[model samples]
Target: MSLSLEGKHALIAGGSGEMGYHAARALAAAGCNITLMARGSEGLTTAATRLINEVDGDVLTVTADLNNRLSIERAVDHAEESLGPIDILVHAVREDVNGYYDQLDVARLQMAAQTLLIGAANLVAAVVPPMQEAGDGRVMFVIGQDAIRGRPLGLGTCALQHGLLGLMRGLAREVAESGVAVNAVVAGLVDTDRLSVEIDQIVAHTRRDRSAVKSDLANGNAQRRLIQPSEIGATLVWLAQDEAKGLCGQAMVIDGGELG
Candidate 1:
């Protein structure tokens, strides 16, 4: 029941996005210092400013490219220097490249993989080792449902998610005894700004009403509504707790029973 992360420092990669922002808010509210990292300086600044007002802990923003290992390293170094060692790492970076498996653009898929999978590897290489050395830490990957079930339009994302799931499992086993837990949150149809944009795109292409398109997405889940961002945020907070060590390498599905 004690989920107080009072002295913990968490680095949320891709922290500018809706999902990441809410996760940072939750972690900060639980008394953890937060470092928001993303490629866009503007979004980082805006997110940090808002978080500073809403949360009790300190918020730092680092503008870095996920695809670049050096950039990730620099960001991590700066965050550790400013807020101490990162006791929790939340990987929520999303690449918007999608195509059918049969007609996939190899180049685009490769690029997406570089950012989502390789970038995650780079982050883990930099962050997890330290946690293992210290013998305490948590890593959570916020990914999509395509990882568990193939989506025809999300070939690239599906590939990346599967790869990330593998990475999480392998790393969890490698570091389990060291007191570091690695897991993933498989999200589905979450109510986010990105989802809204996606819905708009579908409406424009299919000539459907905006409400109809949104309703279709929401209806994909049994709850008949989009998953709230706060729900995902709360789940991340729980997984970050010391007591959740038993959840090693598991993919916690938070899709309102959509997968069912």
Candidate 2:
């Protein structure tokens, strides 16, 4: 079945990054009017320009800090004013401050919580009311595989994903009767520029061969290959379409069998 989102308005948070940028492109290809929100105007403008060049659709870029509630409200409002009412919301925001439990600092932990959990919750709260009134909308969060299987050194990240899942479940139930679906896409180790940088750091810290470390990371998955950001973006586009109406409150894991 074709999942066409023609005429749909989509608002994507963190849309300047790899995953979010790909997601925006996919949605635009599926015929949705797209608005991407990020912290700075420069990255957002660049991403928006790329999408506009790639797809025959309207694309808007907004600068707003996800960590700030007021900023999020203004961003959403601005998007609505520019692109009509939002029919889809995709949150691909991530704050990856890697540290072990003993080494984790309070300020960093608080920032993590604010960005991942609180920011997502605020965005949901801002959009859900109008969506429910209209009796149609799709809200999706981008989670990680480490969320399914708990991580020792990645405790902060896992906590954030878990909290987001809980929030999604509650919102899904609350809006079920109104026909608004809320869900999450659980991602695996993706081969993005950011991940490449992270792998470099890991190799330096562990004093292991880059190839060996990459092999070890892939060994966690049956595919033995890192996922591409566009693959996740395709899945998000599918989930946001009208045909995915039955998929509410589900944390759909796309981990390439890594967690298993």
Candidate 3:
């Protein structure tokens, strides 16, 4: 089936990052009005301009830190003010994670909870109510292996992913009658510039060579290669389209069948 998403408006959080940027580009090509939100204005401007040149849609940029709920709410309002009510909301934002679970402490947990898990809730709250009035909406969170299975050395992250999954599941039920669908896209070992950090964590945990760790992850998938960011973007695009209205409250895994 073809995805023709014209006349929709989308707000992509963390729109300057690889996953978010690619998703924005895909959404723009699908003919939706695009609002790219990120903490820094530099990359957002670059991404918005590049996307504008590539697709026949409006690309707007908003700069705000996700850790700030007020700022997140303000950005949501700004996007709606400029682009109209957001019919699609994709959250591709994440915080930098390093070190092992044993090293975690109260301060770190609180920060992660506030910046990531709680921040996501704030954004969703700000974006969804208006959707109920409009009678159609799609909300998607881009998560990783940490959410589904426990990360060996990244337990703290695993916890947050679990929290996000819980939030999505709960929201999915609450908004079902409102004609809104809430779901997640679970990706694993995707080929992004940030993969180096994941490799580092694996190496530090397994005491293995960087090359060995990288190859192991790449070959872990049935496809024998790292999943591309564009693949994730494509999945997000599909889920937001009208044809996918029946798929609600689900985690569509895009990990090349890594977990059977």
Question: For candidate 2, lDDT tens digit of each residue in 1-260?
Answer: 88788999999988888788988998899989999988888888888888888897899888887768898889889999999999999988887656577877668878888888888888888878899999899998887775677754677777777787788889899998899999889989888887777678777777999988887777778988888887888898899877888997999888788845
How high is each candidate's TM-score? 0.94, 0.95, 0.93
Over all chains combined, what TM-score does candidate 2 have? 0.95
Tens digits of per-residue lDDT for model 3, 131-180: 99889999999887778987566667788888888888999999989899
Indicate the residue-level lDDT of 199 in model 1: 80
lDDT of each: 0.88, 0.84, 0.85
Q: Enumerate residue pairs that collide in model 2.
A: none
Candidate 3 clashes: the total is 0
Q: lDDT by residue for model 1 over 1-260, one digit each (tens)?
A: 88799979999998998888999999999999999999889888889999998889889899887778888889899999999999999999887666556867888888888888888889899898899999899999998887798765677778888888898889889999999999999888888888887787677657999998888788888788889889889999999987888999999999998845
Off by over 4 Å in 2: none
Every model: Cα RMSD to truth: 1.6, 1.5, 1.8
Superposition TM-score, candidate 1 onto the true structure: 0.94
